[model samples]
Target: MLYHCFLLIASLRSVVAMETCPTTGMPGIPGIPGMPGRDGREGEKGEKGQPGAVLHGGLDLQKGEKGAPGMMGYAGKRGQNGEPGKSGSSGIAGPPGQPGDPGAVGVQLKAAFSVARGTHEFPQKASIIRFTKVITNINDDYDTESGRFRCRVPGAYYFVFHASLGNKLCVLMKLDQTLIASFCDHRYRRQQVTSGGLAVYLSRNQEVWMETKDYRGMRGQQNGHSIFSGFLLHPH
Candidate 1:
């Protein structure tokens, strides 16, 4: 009986295993890690990559050395003229100049005449009074025969005349044929005196004389004298 029971139990276990395993048991514990592997061989150099993009951020570089001077360039053409500038202020005056040399001596020009009437005689109308007496006659410009003065020097001259008149007198001083001055005096039954003077510019060879406008009234010698006088003021 004991042997048979043992056999029966073994048979039951075998049949149970053969049919299917019971629910699986819990997993086993993990194993420890292995030693590290050695490094692999370096790879082959890749083809030159495309140029990289410019990076803003980079290491700062040192300053570069100074460059050599360049060659001289050709001269440029002249530019156009600019507008006129404002005038400058006047400068200070300069010192005075040196004194000049003295001038040469000049020639002296002289002409003068003075004449008086000697006799008391009535003169004809429109005729020159002939003064026979001569008080002074420089350069002999006055002619006693014609009773006229011919200008030898072109100049300004001063002429004066005085007449001793009896009854009535009218005398005219003339330059050439032109009347320059006149004097008339009338005092009935009484003696009187008349005088005239003029300053004239005369050219060379121009004539001057005194004449009576009327035939009457001249007194000289015993009475007051009639005189004509002239002198050069300056040569032209």
Candidate 2:
């Protein structure tokens, strides 16, 4: 039995060896070389991918919450800019004003007169003495007494003088030393024989007087009369 087992083992080994070294086909001859390949065209674009698809084996995560809107995106890169605006219109003018009032007047007055004084004479009594008005009085009759008359006030002045005797009379009037009028008669009563008006510009401290051109008491019948008055020559 041992002998048979040995032979059986040898036979199985030989069979395994044969199975390991199996026969192959005969070698074939070399084939001809192939031609050069043509140039290749570009590949077609791939389709758009889904919103959140997995890449390789990685997990497909959802997009995060959108943040606040960015500062308005810097004004959208300005368009083809437009031209500048036109200027505004000018304003209207104002109205004119009203007229003004008239102006005021200036100062004026009388001055002086020589009622009975002589302009030229040699101690002639009861002589014809002329009278006239003077802008500046040069005689001694102009008085600046406290309460009497204002011998200084200026304006036009009027003077009158009359010489009277028992029944004889004579009168004279003057303006600015220029004889203006004279009255003489033998038959006369107490009347304005001489009278005249004068316009003068008498300043302060001037003088005026009156004298007997003819007498009425005895020399030519003796006493004579005289007077002076003042008024404004022009409006102020």
**Candidate 2: worst-modelled 10 consecutive residues by lDDT:** 115-124
TM-score of each: 0.52, 0.25
- List model 1 lDDT by residue over 22-55, tens digit each: 6666998898888999999999998998898564
Among all candidates shown, the one with the greatest TM-score: 1
* Candidate 2, 7-98: lDDT as tens digits: 99999988997888866779999888899899899999999977984565456666667998876655567688689879879768768767
Total clashing pairs for each candidate: 0, 21
The C-alpha stretches of model 2 lying farther than 4 A from their native spots are 1-151, 161-165, 172-181, 189-206, 215-228, 231-236
